[model samples]
Target: MVTNEQRESAFLWTLDLLNEGVVALPLVSQDFSPEDWAFVFEGLPQDLRFSLWKALTEDKKSSILAAMRDDSREQLISLLSNQNLEDVALASSTEQLVEILDVLPKRVVNGLIKKLSPADTEELEDALNYSEEQLGRYVNHDVYSVNKSASVGEALAELKLEDLPVYTDSILVVDDSDHYLGQIDIKLLINSPKDTNVLQLAEFSDHVLAADMTLFDASESVKNCGRSMLPVLDKSGRLLGRFTIKDAIDVYQEYYEEQLSHMGRVSDEDLFAPVFTSARRRASWLGINLITAFAASFVIGIFEEVVVQVVALAVLMPIVASMGGITGSQTLTLTIRGLATGQLASSNLKALGNKEVRVAFLNGILWALVVSAITSVWFDNPWLSVIIAIALIVNMLIAALSGIFIPVLLDRMGIDPALAGSVILTTITDVVGFFVFLGSASLLLI
Candidate 1:
């Protein structure tokens, strides 16, 4: 068995190979995890990284490209020469090519498109015409679709004339005008008699996607249908292309990454990006957070007179605010997740609000009793305990309501709920918690 020291030595040697611009594919294939590959790629110098990438097989290249974050992919693409860029673009699938093009400058993208064949150029131009969030931008244009009136024999003959599209499990059926009809599973087609009409064996589905549909909506359709591929249609019902399960997964991953970046208040940046580039990307949100923090502090400034009158109010004020902030954060996270996953809708808003309020009331009563007992025993003051307990219950209930509404309202305003929701929720909780606790103390205790 290899000792720990020996294992460390082997890992270091592998990393050294990557640094020296050596082809380590055989070793990487046998020993490295996907994460290990990512680590090595990240550690390599720019020139060496490009060399190693160029040496990878098409499948390995695709895997690595998919595994990389947007920033890393963009950095690598920027480092390539025009010829190298053209070669890489030509070698990739329609989906992969779109991803590569997304990071490049518009001029570079146009130049690369010019290098493509006439058919590929047209398809790429079509994809470029759609907005980034639209399904048309990512659909695979290189798909196999036969006329619906064709016989199974004719379909088989067509398949022999050209290679099948990648990741295709079924042949799409279309009309003379290129309107989508349905799909025929290749296995079923193979089993049926050759003279049979293709339409007779076609599996009609109502789950066709529209080219202008948002990626999120298209992914939902793909998931609900559970098909290997879903055909895309234009506004006039003409066939545009097809979206595969792989494409749907890519969309989901992109959406998830965007949400994560938004929550951190940072755009996705390369791990090894230039220091200033990374800082600039983060500075905007940090500035916004600073402003919101001041807003919370201003609310606390208003309660100074009450705090001076009763020292206990100052000591216990944070407890009320902290608890409210935590409770609101829980609700905020859940609501944002529900929105992202399409699990929550406007139709359920009233019902969801009522449910959350009920939960908050129950939890507030239980926790408030515990805190009140502790405060009474410590301070020898029942009235103070009762006041704090009431404050807790009130703040918690408001926190729950604010948490549910803030994200939904922001979403309707075309703002990202995950990015702004936490900040807004914190401000509300702090202001309300401080005002309720201090206002009550000024009236009763002070």
Candidate 2:
């Protein structure tokens, strides 16, 4: 198996070539990792993407389809034969099928659902009703379950006749009405008396997931819970499906990628997506940033007269603004991390904010002294040094506070902090740093 580091290296190297329209199999091995193949799909054009998809085996096609972004998958799926489409629907897991269905034409989706087995058709329908952000979409419906009242021997006999699902550590025990009771491990079943009631030896757990639980909470629960698989129950505690470690990992990976998209404003469509469509998506954010940029510029314009009078202020303006932006950005990054990892919250928010402010204050004073000393010697103006030093300390202190609060405010409002926070922080730091530095110079230096 290829290691993760090696896979990333291959991805990076291959991506460079892909950007230039080369090695795209102008695609690759039918055995390529789903992620790598998805990358290949992203790098190739529409015609070649379909051609490559046709060449891969059915199983490979099923995986790559799930790995693809919704827009790209919809485009590629439009070109598939009805027989091939049914193959994909049948081959996919409940979660994968739900995602695939999300992007398909409604008529296509209806046709595909009709082709599924009755049981699968029901499972997929149940999953389709869930929000993509909920655990229902990601839960696996192929659970191995047994009745709690059944004898161990009876359960063992039935288990032998079925192919176990992946990561089947334990068989879920249920009541006659199909409500979840507990879990009976295979080892326990094998060693116990044949006549023993399955529930007599089962591990009753308080750690079951409700189908309506949010995906973020589900992922966190699956990660922290020691069990390799946890049962998904409906509101009535009936076993609906199971959330596995593998499922948690996939969710985490997807979430990490989503965060990356927010942080970098990267579009879901890969580098090879339609030019104008990609451009249009990017233009929206860049335009918001432009508005913020103008606000910072307006502050600089307010100090235009001060800058003209004190030539030294013009030279030293960027130094204070740059320092504030850098320091504020560092604080912003840490605050966002704490929020994502479930560390920082409103109750303890003040403590972290104070800690960062103190740290920034000390560092600010130190850097200010250093900059002032340089300004004194380089420009031979002591008052000019004093003005910049005051501006630096004030700007950095505010920068630290802004860093802590901005993300919190954005999060509370349901805006993605990673996407909009940086722009807003940069603008605040620039506007404040310039306003204070030049404002002081106007009153003192001139």
Candidate 3:
């Protein structure tokens, strides 16, 4: 409920009071509120601030650090000794650990791995290495699991006896080899007869996903299956971990980030990453686009002579090319989306292509009629209208074919259709539209 400005003023006032020798700073530090701590961290010199950061109670330190920027997080980590870092990490929750690691430099990340206890490091490492779009990234390793043969009484006794994690609610049932058998909801486990086997009351088969499955796919499965936590398994069907709703949400966020990056022609790097590192990561893709653009320009240069002879031909040429390019892009976009979703397949390609071509043809005919009318009115020549109409029809058909086929061909050739499809589509539409329209105009109109 405390505002940032109030927090800041308290921090600066505390510093002023400390400088005045009004009280012992360390004892004063002990009484400092979380908001007051946030203000102090933000107001202090970098070195002294991080020293205080390293000295705070683990929970307070985590809460304070969470409010700080990546630079501050990095500064704190840099100030810590290996032993100090290990102690700080051990006392932190999984959420806090992820937050710290998300901002830490890769070198600092590598160091933290060494600092953690072997068991803790292994658990953290698994989550760290998981694909950003995967359920593994969000799945907590702290879930409780029991054997399928365990009775409800046994499950309850286990829950009461063990130092169970705070967040665990349902006790998962697993085979001897740790394959997911089912999961007993704590409420069901409590209300059922003590003699009932845990497996009898649990729902398992319908709430599981593969380890390598994308978070997007897992989220849809979770929505359809109606469960809070879905078990993740290996190819051998051994239980690996459980993907929670939180993990599904994280995956969706990662996808959204990737989409935003793609729109800006940037590589999907972490937002918390260093600016120079992200710039270096994006340069290669931008370079590739640059090269492709020049290649397209070179193709246009081949017909420069025709452009120089008739200025209007050059002016009107881009109109036909742009229309065809737009048509091709619309078709290509749909095709790629369908292919990614596994909707467009060999069995349906014929029908899908036919539908697209028919749509393109109808669209093309409508535009061609409009352009022909314009040509007749503008040039006062019916022959020019006829030539433009013929060119329009031919270019539209070519655009339709190029849009549908190029990406399919690229997909078959094991290339990323989304990456290369647009450039190739534009090239085809441009070259074909220009040749058809301009060449026709030269013979028929000029």
lDDT of 3 by residue, 1-446 (tens): 44544544455554455444443244455556543464455444333454455455566776555444444466556666656665566566554576576755566568666657776766666666677566565455667899988888888887887886544567788889888877777788899999988888878565678867777898778667666777787678777777776556646655664574455343332222333443344334433543454355456646755665355455456557766776666567656754663435453455456655665576667667876786566546687677767776787678778877899999999999889998898888888888887788778766
Stretches off by above 4 angstroms in model 2 are 5-36, 43-47, 71-75, 78-87, 299-446
Candidate 2: give the clashing pairs.
24-27
lDDT of 2 at 103: 66
Clash pairs of candidate 3?
none
Name the candidate that leads on TM-score: 2
Task: Note the Cα lDDT for every prediction shown.
Answer: 0.70, 0.73, 0.63
Weakest 10 consecutive residues of candidate 2 by summed lDDT: 22-31
Instruction: Supply candidate 3's per-residue lDDT for 434.
Output: 81
- Model 1 C-alpha lDDT per residue in residues 408-430, reported as the tens digit of each score: 99999999988899899889988
The residue pairs in collision within model 1 are none
- Residue 206 in candidate 1 has what lDDT? 83
lDDT of 1: 0.70
Give the per-residue Cα lDDT of candidate 2 at 41: 65
State TM-scores per candidate.
Answer: 0.58, 0.61, 0.46
lDDT over C-alpha atoms for residue 430 of model 2: 94
**Best lDDT goes to which candidate?**
2
**Model 3 Cα displacement at 387 (Å)?**
41
The CA lDDT at 193 in model 2 is: 97
State, as a TM-score between 0 and 1, how close model 1 is to the true structure. 0.58
